[model samples]
Target: MALSKFGFIVTGAGFEPAGKRVVLSSEAFEMIAVGVPAPADALVVARQLASEGVQLLELCGGFGPVWTAKVIEAVGPGVPVGSVGYGPESIDVMHALFKA
Candidate 1:
C-alpha cells in the first residue's frame, strides 16, 4: 500500500503511551527536518527488530537524496520498506528510484 500522512505519525516521539494526552519530546522537534540517510546504525537496528519479529519496516521518505537507494541496498533485495509521504512528488521520486 502507498504511504499516507497518518502513517508518518511516530508514537515514541514523546509521551510513553500512558493512555492519555501525547506529549512531544524536545528532541522530536530536533529530528523534525533532519535527513535520515539510511544510517549504518539503522542496519543494526533493523536487524535487531527483525530478529524480534518485526514484520514491517517504515523508512522516512523525507529528502535525503540517496536514502531510498541505500535502504533498497541495505534491506538486501527481498525485504519491503515503506516510505512515508502522501505527496505526488514523493510518489514520483519513489517510483523513479525504486523502479529504476
Candidate 2:
C-alpha cells in the first residue's frame, strides 16, 4: 500500500523477539512471513511508531486484545485518535474521539 510521507504500517510479526529481524524502511516494516509471538518488543515499537506521527497503523489478525491495548496505551490520552471500525465518516467523530 502507498503511504503518506509521515505514514507507517505495523503488523504483529514485526514484534517478535526470536524473530528479532524487525526493521523499518522507507518501503515498509520488515518482518517474519508466518506468525510469530511478540510481547514487550511489540509494545516498544508501537510506542515509537505512534510517537513518530504514523497516520495509520495496521495490525495483524493475530495481535489480539493484548497488542491492541498496548497500542492504545502507547497512543495515550494525547493526539488525534479514533477507531477505524467506527468509520471515518465525519470530522465530528474524529473531534469527538480526540477531544482535549
lDDT for 73 (candidate 2) = 80
> TM-score winner among the candidates?
2
Model 1: how far is 4 from its true place, Å? 19
Candidate 2 lDDT (Cα, whole model)? 0.47
> What are the models' TM-scores?
0.39, 0.42
* Regions more than 4 Å wrong, model 1: 1-40, 63-65, 86-100
Candidate 2 worst ten-residue window by lDDT: 78-87
Q: Write the per-residue lDDT of candidate 1 for residues 1-100, one digit (tens) a residue.
A: 4321111112222323221122223532311111223344355444443444334556554424365456556656445555655677567766786663
Per-candidate local distance difference test: 0.41, 0.47
